[model samples]
Target: MNGLRVAVLSFAHEHAASYISLLHDRTDVELLTADPDFATAPADELRGRGFAARHGAAYVETYEEALAWGPDAVVICAENARHRDLVLAAAEVGAHVLCEKPLATRVEDAEAMVAACDAAGVVLMTAYPVRFSPEFATLRALVESGALGVVLGGTGTNNGKLPAGRSWFTDPELSGGGALADHVVHVADLLDALLGEEAVAVRAVTNRIVHGDDPRVRAETGGLVSITYAGGAEVTVDCSWSVPDGAPTWGGLTLQVVGTGGVVEIDPFGAHVGGVVAGGAEQAWLGLGENLDALMLEHFLGCVRTGSTPGPDGRAGLRSLRVVAAAQESVAAGGAVVRLTPSSAR
Candidate 1:
């Protein structure tokens, strides 16, 4: 296949910068970026700070004009609320889509995005790049090969430092619910990839612990969520933004998966994986490949050429969002456990 031509729709999402860098550096891709109202203070500041790359790519005032650039696929990096409309538009225009996490704020819109892509007969992949992480892939292969025996449950944690530059992220409407909604779904998607099944229930506890000292923000700084998969496997997810600034250990994301035979632990920062051995714990660290964002771009382009389905497709994202929505609903309803509809087997 020839090189893949791609364009980005919005620059609101934090990961947009990373995507731009990936596209800029990849020789096989021709990248364009468009963002309406780029002169806004926030947008300009982001550009100055290097978050908005693809400065050479054509910029248009509206998305419709941007789509006319002849992109083979579109990367929808808009705000959570704008994802549904943007994805539908891309699919309608006959372009495959690579949308950021949390496909849409609502399940109904997510379903619509899925339907749009299905009707258009183009791919609609969600960015759950964690599945491609070396540690995660290794653990998944082990479990699938029965090296870990029957699976039981897993524990995942990602206590990232607070987002500093992006002020809009504090707005629940713009960024979605909070920490649990932001981070837990990534783990849910990863669990689905590893277990080859969907999550069936969610029971979560969320709280707004940060006063935003600025007195103007009210985003959550931390939370815990427990998810139950269809095969009876459970996952305890812990995420927060409380890690202190400039600390040597700025943030950490780790996972511990248990099986009938043994346990597997993954430390993403170091790309390390460890297993419990007879004497103690044996560990191995993986070499990084620039970062996950670059790897994700490569995977997407490869899938486009090979006619392969991206694992975290629109339906997969919808499944994760259903679990997230159930978790949010559970938290609102006094922490009551919520039962989710089984995902349609894809």
Candidate 2:
């Protein structure tokens, strides 16, 4: 088709900025953005028109206005709980979607979003930029090629500082859970893509001890989750918001995979030079490598134009959502094992 008309539905999530920045400069993309929820945002927070203007994208007053503009596709970056409504709205308008992660706060809502997009004959791609990392690609290649032999178990971590600008990240009602919800999905999605095996069980432990001093922080700030795949491979994920405020970067993800033949590890964000910059008050890390978000967006837009399915599609999102749901169930049961029935995994 001709140049694509795309709408960015909200700016609640931090990644929205990167996405807007990437799309704004693309000549083949006509970008429009809306954040009606911004009306109630704190005065100090950048949202709505100001955020859109800063990113050099066209702004609309509401999601309704943006959808009515007839976008061929949309990027939904709303709060976790708000994803369902935005996704249904986009699907109703027959617009392909690339939704922000943790898909939804609940499994039923995620299932509904997937079904709506399927019924509308529109693609629903989940935002999982980590899958686009070259380092991760190499890991997947090694695993697939039997260089790692039969996978036994592994340890993964997706840790970061508590989100600074967005209060919703700590609100369970808006963000789903906490560190578990915010960080688990990326590694879970990666494992799912790597193993292609159903997750048979999950056990998780979470605590609010990290930010317990803040009354507003009701959700968990630290967690450790263990998942068992159908093939008997167990993976433990430390999805915690444990990075200190003074850290040079927010945080990073790393995975150590152990198999029968050998072991492999990947640190997607490790390609960086860290030191104190000249005349700078604090330490700094200059990243080196391809931008995973740009690669992910390019893939999504390519699928949009070709009418092909996107990797980490709605079903992939649903699978990872189930893992989080199971993890929450396990947490509620005092970290007891929560077995996932095959039907539930689907």
Candidate 3:
């Protein structure tokens, strides 16, 4: 463990697969160990070992063992509810953390995670790969630079295929509230980064229309959330798992920002090199422009090495968590407008 030792906290999240591979390949990282405690399959466990061994690391069964390896930083791929504890533990060890999205199941937990990291004086960065996306960064610039010309409002959509294999994603205790929780934070944080504002109030509603009466579909798979900011600018987000399995691709997002000058529409995945197929019955979508995850990791590890606080940090995570918490409250209250007050403000 010489230059930038790293550890993976869990294999509970699907992202761990790609993230481990990337870390193993990085020449700058001296060690990369993955604690594969919750790996679902033997194959997955083997894969984690392979990813670790390639970087001269040994598999660790427990998080404590992984920490004992003396990592400079840790990547948390734990469940949403487990985020708070993992963050607290990692920060306690004086390791900077880069955690997955939807920070935690509750706003209080997200707040506590931020406080713990702050108390430890360790960087607490959230994994918001969309912020590093080139197309998204370009759109953010357009919005912030007044190129959009006095923005009126915006319409955002992130309709993606259901996480078919991941049952914990819909579990209320693990993933928070489902569609609204999973999808809201991406665009919410993106807009906050672009506009330097957070929503003051929100009204949201959900429907269990997908999955056809399967009780495993315990969470809402389709939903609409309306967020209003202090400046009266509003955004209606179609944050749902409404995409059918028949879709050729994994689904995508679209953002339309209207302003006095004109409307700026950004489809980060719209520019595809592929063409229509099967008499236009199905179109092959190839929206693989950039590896935003790699870029985000690069930034996080650089901060770990330099001891600099990173962007889209725990505060950003907390703000998005508050917005989702408000949305959930609105849903429970029959789509009533729930006022948003960030936990940090309190």
Number of the predicted model whose lDDT against the real structure is largest: 2
Clashing residue pair totals per candidate (backbone < 3 A): 0, 0, 0
Over the stretch 36-116, how does candidate 1's per-residue lDDT look in tens digits?
Answer: 734443643464223343355555667887788777899988878889988888887788899998998888989999998
Give per-residue lDDT, candidate 3, residue 152. Answer: 78
Angstrom error of the Cα, residue 1, model 2: value is 6.7
lDDT at 173, model 3: 79
Query: What's the distance in Å from true for residue 22, model 2?
Result: 0.5
How much is 40 displaced in model 1, in angstroms?
6.6
lDDT per residue as tens, model 2, 13-114: 999999999999899999999999987667888999999988888998989999999999999999999999999999999999999999999999999999
Best by TM-score: 2
Q: Candidate 2 at residue 237, lDDT?
A: 99
- Stretches off by above 4 angstroms in model 3 are 35-57, 275-283, 342-346
Q: If ranked by lDDT, best first, what sequence of candidates would result?
A: 2, 3, 1
C-alpha lDDT (0 to 100) for residue 282 of candidate 1: 38
Better of 2 and 3 by TM-score: 2
Q: What's the CA RMSD for each of the models? A: 5.9, 1.3, 3.1
Model 3, position 17, has a per-residue lDDT of 69
